[model samples]
Target: MVRGKTEVRRIENAASRQVTFSKRRNGLLKKAYELSVLCDAEVALIVFSSRGKLWEFSSSSRKLLGETLGTCSAAELHELGNQLEESLRQIRKRKQCILAEQIAELREKEKSLLKENKLLHEKFKGGNMLHLNAAEVQSMEVNTQLMIGRPGTL
Candidate 1:
């Protein structure tokens, strides 16, 4: 019997975690070897430590099993990566298309505003010309009064 069962969650105390990992790793390798010998079966196992160290064992011919498993793993990873990349590409294209439509809408609004401004400018110009003609008539009346300074000349 042992003291307590260990949880899979991270161990806050580094020293305890290291001790546990060492014990468990040895036991796992021993079990794999025993199973292979007793059952006359092939076994392959790979483990990576928290520190990135790799551990592996195979009961069958190492060359044959390693080649076969490696090939399959590569193929599966390639397929998964392709799927993820295609999904991302589709998302980006949709975003670009939406932005393009927004830009077109803004351009149409700008054109409408420009046409309204042109009409306002034309109205202002016409009103200003009318005021100028009225001023000219007032000047002409003042000149006529000066020319008829003598009452008999009227």
Candidate 2:
């Protein structure tokens, strides 16, 4: 019997809807997998049924597991190794650049903090404890004790 094109609408029967969803979801996932493999393209598919059941399919390389190595030539293996090395080099370069930027930022902060500490030290001079422009007492031998702590510490 030839099946005619059915109207696209919600299935009235819950059981029929569930069965249809199951069949169609499997078909779509299989198609996606086939497409990814045949085209060497990435495919990701997700399906949620009426009962909130979830099904997902994702396609990525499995060469890391040595599953597809039997089909590779020596040249292919060497090429793969070179690709991995290049990827590692790129990753290391990026990491080093980011670390350099962070170090530079931290050094700038340290410089600013040091400058502030110097200004604070100037505010509490050890000898006079108060700064005046071109003014001095006749007796400069008397001394007092003052306790000071570094910034960001007790």
Per lDDT, the best of the predicted structures is 2
TM agreement with the true structure for every prediction:
0.39, 0.44
lDDT of each: 0.74, 0.79
Which stretches of model 1 miss by more than 4 angstroms?
1-8, 63-154
lDDT of 2 at 154: 53
Q: Candidate 2 clash total?
A: 0
| Model 2 global lDDT (CA atoms, 0 to 1) | 0.79
Top candidate (TM-score): 2
Q: What is candidate 1's lDDT per residue for 108-127, written digit by digit as tens?
A: 99999999988888887876
Q: What's the residue-level lDDT of 21 in candidate 2? A: 85
List clashing residue pairs in candidate 1.
Answer: none
